[model samples]
Target: MSAPTATAPVGQTDTDASAPRRPRRKLLFIGIVVAVLLAGAASYVLVLGPDAAADEAVPVVEEGAVIEVGTLTTNLAGTPAQYARVGVALVLSADADQSEVTARFPLVKDAAIAEIGRHAAASLQGEEGLEPLRRGLTERIQAVYPDGEVVRIALTELLVQ
Candidate 1:
């Protein structure tokens, strides 16, 4: 009689079948990572878009205060035949109070009166002569406050003697 031969169990081999499944699991892990990155990027863009647009639409304003000016009077230097006496109502701007304008009133008044007396004709016959004088006086008032401007100059009373 021959000795009994040794045999292996069914469906059991020395090589592993789970080796192929490892590659498929790695591919699934990479896909999940890429999907998470894309979702994070999309969320950031949607959140900040409106705030960026609104910031551009707003405007900035300057800060300061406004002051009202009253009328000033001064004498014109010249003979009665050569010059006409003028009275003007002017509106000006200043950062200081009425007291400051009052202190500088004499200087501003004199400058305006002198300019008008020198440039204007003694007898203004028509609109041509009057228009030039009005513009000239307005410019003179502006000189007093270089930073400020004159809004209006009205010849309330004008007398030639």
Candidate 2:
């Protein structure tokens, strides 16, 4: 008979049989570790990276003070005798004096009415109309005050008929 061969224990495989499995398990473990590391690096570079600060640079601007100038009704410039009822408010610059603006309320109201009367009923139809109206009112009020106190004009209410 040939030389007797070596055999593993009844419940276990020989070392040579398990050697290949050890290397495969090691390779799988290494692959998982590499994948985890790559994912972490990608996340940090995309989300929490250096460019984040520049992307987050949103400036905060303070809104100036506002003064309400009550509503006024005036006849529009167009034919057929149209009238517009408008409510006005003034946004004052940061250094403007509240008491001064309050004292000159009548002049402000008059200028607002005059400006409204310059625009036709059709001109005051939509946002296209209202923006110019605001700018004109601001200019007139500025002319009366001449102090640059009024920074913007807001139309709180508007109705044409």
Candidate 3:
């Protein structure tokens, strides 16, 4: 009655069987997670290379000549008369001679006008249309300026009515 004797509780054990193994299991799980993370990072580097985002940038051509096609007024391909007035500027190759480009303005303008006329009014509405239009314009302009190809065709102004 004065003091309780040293004895184990009814449902409790003196030593826990899983006490040491719990910490070890936690550590093993942590190690496995770290290993997986490291593997993922390694695979990403291997697949995409070190500078993944850097690889996606477009290259700028230095000393590029620009030729203005002026404002092109044309009717779109439809039953109703829908016209488009687009001001285009052609960025010629870096190797292009400014003098030659000036001389070949007629050819360049003609090609660009023809290219613009090829598209329907609805097809040139969104961002999706810009790429195809650019590609087509480049192809058209490059035909005449084969030596100094058109690197880029920029739409300085666009209007459809």
Candidate 4:
């Protein structure tokens, strides 16, 4: 029935308009703080140079000179029917005497095989046993080359069958 009232009925105000602006202000402040923190880090690195302690703590050592002593297959001490074949590799220093180490390869192989033959299957299964074996091999190899050419010895391939 009646003709419509053409005007707004009333007392509502635009209160929510400023509510959305408050959140945008908070976000802008947070972004500025983050940017400042990142800029500070960049400037620190650029002005003071790289952190020497971090650089010294973990100096990446390059594998310079390397030698692969051939694989050795020998029966273990106590465990019969179980044989171990270890492929050995040695990392040498840049100043290492390659000729001297090459000349003593036989002794190194013999020492490694004999040391490996002393341990049983159980003793050589995990790190506990592997550590001593590695130490033994290192000592034996280093004994042959007192110049300390051999930096590290790795059993690249180890299989017990």
Candidate 2 per-residue lDDT, tens place, 38-151, comes to 999899888789677776795433447998989999998987479999999888888888999889999988888889999999998889988999889988988877867777
On residues 2-117, what C-alpha lDDT tens digit does candidate 3 reach at each position? 79766667875657533566788999999999999999999999999989878778566664777787888887777448878888888878787777777877887888778878
How would you order the candidates by lDDT, starting with the best? 2, 4, 3, 1
Stretches off by above 4 angstroms in model 3 are 1-46, 49-63
lDDT of 1 by residue, 61-122 (tens): 33233332344333334554555656665554433344554566666677766766665354
Give the range of the ten consecutive residues with the poorest summed lDDT in model 3.
Answer: 12-21
Alpha carbon RMSD to native, model 1: 17.8
Clashes within 3 Å, all models in order: 0, 0, 0, 0
Instruction: Choose the strongest candidate by lDDT.
Output: 2
After best superposition, candidate 2 residue 8: deviation in angstroms? Answer: 91
Give candidate 1 regions above 4 Å deviation: 1-80, 93-97, 120-123
Give Cα-based local distance difference scores for all models. 0.59, 0.86, 0.80, 0.81
- RMSD to the true structure for each prediction, in A, is 17.8, 10.1, 7.4, 10.3
**In terms of TM-score, how similar is model 3 to the real structure?**
0.60
TM-score quality measure for candidate 2? 0.59
